[model samples]
Target chain A: GAGVSQSPSNKVTEKGKDVELRCDPISGHTALYWYRQSLGQGLEFLIYFQGNSAPDKSGLPSDRFSAERTGGSVSTLTIQRTQQEDSAVYLCASSLGRANYEQYFGPGTRLTVT
Target chain B: AQTVTQSQPEMSVQEAETVTLSCTYDTSESDYYLFWYKQPPSRQMILVIRQEAYKQQNATENRFSVNFQKAAKSFSLKISDSQLGDAAMYFCASKGPSGTYKYIFGTGTRLKVLA
Candidate 1:
């Protein structure tokens, strides 16, 4: 079953532009996550990938936020300069490891940042 | 610093009646895990029931159930029969077995299934 998948379901960049959101975990799911749901931040937790060692970026929220997961499933968060409080809704989850094992979401990427 | 608390932002029930969504959390770690996510409106974050803070017995899923009160860190969600597609937004999460498993959401509660 193709469960998690996220892409440009909706994106509208502008302010300082720099956006790239994509995730596709659900083939072997070794845990992958990235969340951000603003409206004053309701769902936070911005980076975590397990299986390629070195991810848990500590809820990335700075360094302009970055992510990568190539060859291990496909993930790419990257939000360099976009602001407007970064708009919101860029969720992507996948799990089967990494501590908890019940995450499977993707239908997000509503970033606006205008 | 785990913290999740949904003080009911909005709620209504009647599609078949039975609703209760309240969650509280502030973990200090005790081997934890508790969730109840369901964000429809196409937001997609569904996983409607889970609790394993050592499991005291209170996680159901047929009609959804949870009332795990692990020493007052209460986790409630009992929606039975209520369905208007069950309305949406109902997060309440908390994860803490540590090891890069972060999650602590709960400022959601919009559930309106009145029919």
Candidate 2:
């Protein structure tokens, strides 16, 4: 009955540092996704993981953004060498399958790079 | 290229009234899906309604309904009996049929409900 959940609702880090955001998808959900939400902007796709298949990293803005889902459940998105432009909300979502029409979203982590 | 557009950045409606949020999208795939998601101050994306490309009939969910114009590549959300709780940011998204379910989202429309 629980929905998707993310940790560190808010995170503040200095420039050039590294930070990791966590996401716990719904039970039995085999598909997970990450997105970035800049202030006053739309949601930008980040990365995706579906079952045991290779994750889709095309949406990732740069090599600094990487994510991995272990045991097919929890996912962690790590941002290396954070910059001020990285200040945004990181959102995670999950669906029953990779092509499932509907996706359930998490509360999101508000990351701030100073 | 797949793209969703929300022309209206903001809209206002009185309580118990009706308001329509416009959305249009362009894609090469004929078999696709459109969705409307609401995001309140809580920042959680909640599905409001969805429409399948093959379905000629509009999709309705309680007070929420969509006008799906396939030819025009438009899917607009019409909210009736608007309530204060319905006030939030509405986003229009479109996704292809296969490969991945990643959706192309619009900039979003901020709806303000006046009591």
Candidate 3:
């Protein structure tokens, strides 16, 4: 009955550092996605993972952004050499096999790159 | 590429009144899904309603309803008997039937419900 969840609701890091955001999807959900929300940009899809298939990294702005889902459940989005432009809310969502089902979202992590 | 548009950046409605938030999208695909998500101050995205492109009939969820016009690529949300709790940011999103689980979201509309 639990919904999607994310850790470190807020994170503050200096520029050039690396930061990792975690996401815990709902049980039985095989599809997970990561999106970034900023003041300038609305909500932009970052990556998507379905079961054990290769994740969709097409939306990654640069090579610095990467994500991994361990055991097909928990996902971690890592940003290398974080820049001030990376400051935004990182949101994670999950759905039931990525069909017509609705995707449930998490509270999100507000990352501040100073 | 699919694009969702919410022209109204903000809107207000008195309690128990009705308000309609406009949304339009551009997509070459004929079959897709349109959704309305609400985000409160807590910033949690909540699904309000959804419409299937193939479904001619509109979708309704209690006080929340959607006017889906496939010809115009328009999907607007109508809230009746508005309540204070309705104050939140409403986002319009579209997902293509291309088997990719990506959703394109609009800039969102901030709705303020007044008593």
Point to the candidate with the largest DockQ. Answer: 2
Evaluated at residue B101, the lDDT of candidate 2 is 78
**Sort order, DockQ high to low:** 2, 3, 1
**Which regions of candidate 3 fall more than 4 Å away from where they truly are?**
none
Per candidate, the number of residue pairs that clash is 0, 0, 0
Top candidate by lDDT: 2
For candidate 3, the TM-score is 0.97
Interface RMSD of each: 7.2, 1.4, 1.8
Q: What tens-digit string does per-residue lDDT give for candidate 2 at A30-109?
A: 99999999987889999889999999899999899899999999999999999999999999999998556679999999
TM-score of chain A of 3: 0.96
| Candidate 3 lDDT by residue in tens digits, A1-114 | 999999999999999999999999999899999999997456999999999899889999999999999999999999999999999999999998756469999999999999
Clashing pairs in 3: none
Ranking by TM-score: 2, 3, 1
Q: State the weakest 10-residue window (summed lDDT) of model 1 chain A.
A: A38-47
Residue-level lDDT tens digits of model 1 in A1-114:
789989989999899989998989899888888989986347888888888788878878789989999988998999898889888888999888855568898988899877
User: Model 3 chain A: which ten-residue window has the lowest total lDDT?
Assistant: A95-104
- For residues B21-109, could you state the per-residue lDDT of candidate 2 as single tens digits? 99999999978889999999999999999888989999999999999999998899999999999999999998898664778999999
